[model samples]
Target: MEKVMMILAAFVLTSTSRPPEHKYVYVDELKNWTEAQRFCRQTYTDLATLESQQDVEALSDMATSVRKTSELAWIGLYDDVNSWRWSTSDSDFYQHEEMDFNNWQAGKPNNVWLGLFRDSWKWVEGKNFSFRFWNEGNNEPGNNGKEECAAAHFGRSGQWEDWPCDQHKAFVCYSELCGNASLPGRKYFFVGELKTWTEAQSHCREHYGNLAVMENMEDVGTLNNMAASLGFTSTAWIGLYDDVNSWRWSVSEYDLDQHQENKFTNWQPSEPNNDAGRESCIEMFANGSWNDITCSKLQGSICSEVRDSDVKFTFINVDMNWTQAQSYCRNHYTDLARVRNMTDIQKIQTLIPAGQNVWIGFHRPFWMWVDGSRFSFSYWRSSEPSGSGEHCASADLGNSGQWENWDCDGQRPFICYNVVCGNSTLPTREYIIVDELKTWTEAQRYCRENHKDLATITNMEDVRMLNDLATGRTSQAWIGLHEDVNSWRWSMSDQYQNQFRNWAAGQPNNKFGRESCGALSADGSWYDVSCSQTLHTVCFNVCGTNPTFYYSSTKRSWTEAQSFCREHYRDLAGVRHLSDNKVIQGLVQRAAWMGLYRDSWKWADGGNSSFRNWNRDEPNHNGKEGCAAANFGNAGKWEDWSCGEKKAFVCYAAVQSKHLVKLQLEFPSSLTEDDSAMMEELLIKLKQKLKDDGVKGDVKVSWRKRPDGKILHKPKKKKDEL
Candidate 1:
């Protein structure tokens, strides 16, 4: 059954001298699950936990009274899956079974379309130990009666399967020390005789540590080498065995460590169905609703903190979003309340007089940055992000940087950040200001071409920079923050990789479940959609050089634009400077194409900073497209694009900043006209004279029109003067 898992600790009121009531702090902040936990632990008790229906009612009442929107305050309840340990008994390997809890970060062991296959299998390895390459369908472990031994199919995607023992087939052996190499040797050899799984295990145990325990892809590669060397083809047994119902919670039993069984079960209807055998983690919505979900999806979390004082509870009365509340509690009180026994539950009932929802530290998994950064910060608007289709996030310049959820397909303005070049100075950071209303992907391409890739904000400093840039702007703009949901990457190769994403409401629907692209919508939100659809794009180029962008009215596929760019100039335009965006934005009116496309959401700079700004349910991956674009019409947010779509595109050329300045010179009327003509000749002499003067920098001069919009020329003699 999928029930919200929580860590319980009892605090009983020993003396009647103490007040019969506990204080429940209602902090209103917007933070992800983990951040709230830290806040609660540091400031107050852990997130409020409910021991009974009465406790739930009390918390609900307080939440209903205080909450501004339907946003649920975090509670001390979460899923405890992915906490498997290895059979080897070394706890280190499984310490973080929940390390990259999001399935996108570390694909889970379940039956899903993972590329192409749906097989049910169990890891004999500890609940913490999860690593597999199983074959499709019935070839998986526990597939047939009496099929208990596991083997690797070397030729076909290196997947694994179970087979009956006593079937004579080749086998691979594992050794912590093999062939006297001292190294944990995986020297596999084709043991010619077909033996049952048990027999193979015994033989390998005698010769080495055990049958080849394939730990990672590297081990599989080693097996491939062994198979090639021996030329033995057919099924080969390895050490893996099946213990089908071996699921466990990641929560430490030491909160009573000895108790492994879940004492409580509160599952929603049709929940814990183990959909596709992947829904192992538990979660609860506001209203005390409980359900099971895959560990990979992203959600707000709940955390606990022990209090040194005698007070069993503290109620924060501030009204912040979940993230904000978590930040407040962490700074002042402990984390969200962590209710343990019925005593604390009763105390909570007496503490809060109203209903309100707040944030606790609970990790509900979702799309994660491939760089593996923490999901700590969030800034969501009220009653925002309400949809199941797909969503992305956007920041409203009109609303003091407040953000709202949006659709990836919708076009909008966006923001992009740059890596600090020389030092930690404001001038060292480059920002691209793409004014053209292009799709998020196009803006990203423009930014990459002129300045850096889309802006990648690191902390509040970056956000401030964006706000400062948006001071007089009415429409919000696009930033280099977006998510593909399947994975996150950057468009440019020279920029830093920061995990900062902004999605919109129910965006990224991935309508048809194949939309792997991203876009920016109006309201500065992000969305996902098929890349083939055409939209406006932004482009940028090197300042002081020839025009950076080359607009072609003839629409072409993204691939074709890339080809055209490579052939004529450089690969599609890359924006590396903020000024460059402003320069290029004036060139296009409608949505066009840029070089930016979705490739597992990796950053071009490769610096892993996990910061996401998703609007709401987003990155739906509809239409089987895998590209990205920037939407300038909608405030420059982001959305997905298709590589094959034919759209107007922007290309750029790289050039260094020119130090020379253009000046218009007029000869004094006193001088003869011949002197002005001789001025050109005199300039040659002046150049030599300056060289003799030993200037540190080179000086180059060019002709320019006068302030009156006319080229410099000898003033015509006034007729009266003549």
Candidate 2:
């Protein structure tokens, strides 16, 4: 019969708690945006989503606490320009013909469709036409030659006539009016983990709502406040990106409105003819007239500053490309100047030197949020979102949380958020040794029937624990560790694979193909040997931190040593690095047994831990040298040899414990007993409060439901013969 041992367990549940409206978690890991998103989904909620000022504040506070004042982290935001929508969706917003109205920028909306060249002359403003008054006597629009453009001949009763497109003639321009609006709520977190934009999006979608989306100035202000609290600044991913469509002002406010009079243009005759396809920026001639030009051209620029109802224009003599000029103006002034009317244009004209062109505030539109939120709110730093290919957005904490566009592949830390569910706790284990002599299989059976199972050592902490338990006990024992020759890995599984190694030269020569166990030499090198060899062993009790080594004079087979180590210590010793090998080498005077053996490298409890400390170029499987061992003579490097060789061995184990705390309850009348979700929220708050109060360890909080399925009840009113 198997003997089962019972350990102490305790816990407590209470009422009366309040959790934050939004919970944000800052992960410190570094990964691409997609990986970060996946981690967030698995570990917490999702990438931090900021819908309101409160959310931003929450994230800011968290960031300050972590002391990650200066760094960029991925958020749940991205760009999806392909999903375009009209600025206004109201059916009544446009009349029949108005719906087809278009005012493409110069040289845009490429003309690729088949159409009659001579008869297809269209309005420059993209307007439809039905009436025509041609210079009939002059055979106007005759397409007599290469006349691709039309001109109104004042000399002929104002009738239209075809003319060469390149001819320099006076032209007409127009303007229209536009307006802006706003929306609202959510929470945020400041993750310190780094990831790419796409990765961050995945993480946020899986774990939380989505990347932070700011829909109004209120949100921007809140985000700014959050960054201000940090006393330092850095950049982080946000939920805005460019889609490369539409056209708008750099300030984001003065967009094309509904009224025609509000729209204004002063393009010189046939001026905005889009010389090439590259003209995406606007430039003003010295005469205060406007024309479309390539954004890459260097030129002076005008900046406008708004004070109350008055606007002031300042000219910057520095020559730079459109984007650069925009940035400079933003950093030093309000923004590229906006000419609202002829008066404003005249004001700007006075600021310009003769015959000098300057950049203005107009630009092609392409920015949008990752979550499909309304693109109403914006808080961009001066000249941000300037680069053509930078379609991802990040918040510069150093700049009061202002936003900037960046490449999607650039790595950065991220923030994640989740709903408060309850408390959190971590699981642990303990180890013990049993004096016995048995084969590897028999030892495993014994441990399973007795203690939890054969000891499974993971980190140096486990080694330390085994060292503590080995004091005064038999120096030799069996442990629960083995290896699989086919797939090289440890039985306990984790995210990290064995990356560090120190191997002996030309090692692991399986003499007779029977070697399946590992041993250590006095000089700290490794070798495989037959499992039947008998060896002494070292054992440990607790798990955590640094590890110590011990040696015994007794000898046992590889299998016997493994069993002895398991009984006396945690398991066979697992040297993780040069330091660990050095420590073990100092203890052994000759050869000894270790935990590493060959099979499929698995823990006795069937853990999938991928931590392996091997010697360089070892386990070469030389002549079927399947077993592994440490050779102290070779700087504690590893080698492959037969398992049948006799040597001493080491063992290790982990220490485990649990605690429970009980508490009384109180609740506001508004909260009912059936509000389980609210109860969960309160529990989460309590957990956070504990953390705030310096409670450490893998502590978890939860409501221990009673047998009657109730965790809270109103206390019976006390009656005293009233």
Candidate 3:
């Protein structure tokens, strides 16, 4: 192994060079954030993604000649709040590193609702009432893998179980006490008469009062006793019906104040009898007393006028219904009179004829009882009423007891009650779960009718108690934890894992809890802003050897700019490095958008860079600002802004460099220029050697051809030898 080896040296010549890292372009077209992004991507690489002061300066210089001074241009920096966060937002509840705790199963949180079990349950009506009566024998909720609805079984002493929502079962409906115990003496009567809801209403009005308006739990108890006495264990019609058209005032502005003055009514001793179940409009007598009347009834209207902030009334002797009167008043005067206070009534009373009733501005409520009682008490099952076309209400007397909206034309047994001019009282009842398989909504109705409501868990102790209650029944049960789809998330799906942040002082404050976007400042800080603000935008292009940036002097909103960048370039510039911040900062003449936005906070590109540069107390999260912009006037810091704001933008593109490399080498005497294959082999070896020497990127090596259309020519003999 220690043998001496003869060595031969070969003469060679070589030259090499490299291209610049990136190139920038400045466009002077005036477009929105999105429009500018499109132009840049189509004409150049993409919106500029700055990475250093030099890069910013180059862009600035290029733009200075064509763009106005102090003008904001789009940049490739934005805000993204779409990141992973806990469902629990209470900061104090989590200790150090606890907020990051995770016990997810392998390949869990896969962004889809699969066969996983939910941590909690909820009532159909979304109430977190602390009560549990689950049938634990069969693992009740189990969601049964697909069962989302809950039901109570009377056979199980009111214990609950889960089932599919579409399952048909008898249900229960209940009404609250009217609270007005002085409204004459009312008694419930079971009409065993099978009629459509409409026909039933007509029959009830003609015979008793209106189909028994159960206004309270006492009323419910009364009806239950009556049904039990008659052994009528079946579904039946009730007076409560869906009045799809919501009540409103002729003046839209007054509608906003309706809630505050909802209790203000000047009914003339039960004047709103709702005769024939068709009275849905309001009328005022000369004495200022109000009455419910059919909307189709023709009558004179009282119009109001606003003069010097004081309302005045004008009576029009036109015979028109509520709708026509409203239009007429709006065209001729301000609008139908709105009785805000006693003063308004007095003013309108003076204009009314001695015994005439004039139309007023009030309309009927969405839900109404045939007896003209206030529709205050409700016991709707979870996601019930369908809200599609079902207008009539029905009570399930045999199954998971609950209230539901039904078709008015559907025939069913009915319950009717009469007023007997005497006071009456009812007794209390105990909770009893119905024994029937029905939807969660249906179960809720049954519970509300027979008991109080579905169980609502508030704490772990409640959970334990519920578990104990369901010990021998179903294992899973419904509680009251509705899933909210609205949460912090990133716009770019792939960049969700990024945790980098750069906030300005007091930024991301989520002021008013509306801010959800991110922004960049001139000083290289970050901020939380709105997504609708218009600003300059930045884009990036990585199609070349290296990332390059460009500046579009057009203004656009954050989203529009994003669409433009993604459509043409790689995406909005994602500055995951301090170097990138510096580069972007230098180019900023004004605040611009970047790829640092968030539904929670993420970059436009799916980069894992975690670099950040924030000003003190940044990301205040003020307003509904959900987009990110870079403020150049403040030293290229970041601030959240409305994405709809139009401003200039920046984009970037990638480029490749070519170098004319030359090399000379001495070979053995036996090797000749005609050995083209050997020369190619040598070039390949040279390329490999360069790679081994730490050279990156694409490298090519080839022999240079001479004027004689040949390469690797033999060297000429020395002058002395000649």
Model 3, residue 98: C-alpha shift (Å)? 17
Give per-residue lDDT, candidate 2, residue 338. Answer: 72
Please give the RMSD to the true structure for each candidate, in Å.
30.3, 26.8, 35.6
The full ranking of all candidates by TM-score, starting with the best, is 2, 3, 1
Per-residue error for 106 in candidate 2, Å, reads 51
- By lDDT: ranked, best first: 2, 3, 1
- How well is each residue in 206-254 modelled by candidate 2, as lDDT tens digits? 5354566666666555555655654436787886765443344566333
Give each model a TM-score: 0.20, 0.25, 0.24
lDDT of each: 0.41, 0.56, 0.55
lDDT of 3 by residue, 378-436 (tens): 76656665644577888765633357777789898887654432222221112222335
Instruction: Please estimate how well model 3 matches the true structure, expressed as its whole-model Cα lDDT.
Output: 0.55
Give stretches of model 1 more than 4 Å off: 1-182, 189-207, 215-217, 232-254, 257-265, 268-273, 285-290, 308-722
Candidate 1's TM-score: 0.20
Count of backbone clashes for each model? Answer: 213, 139, 186
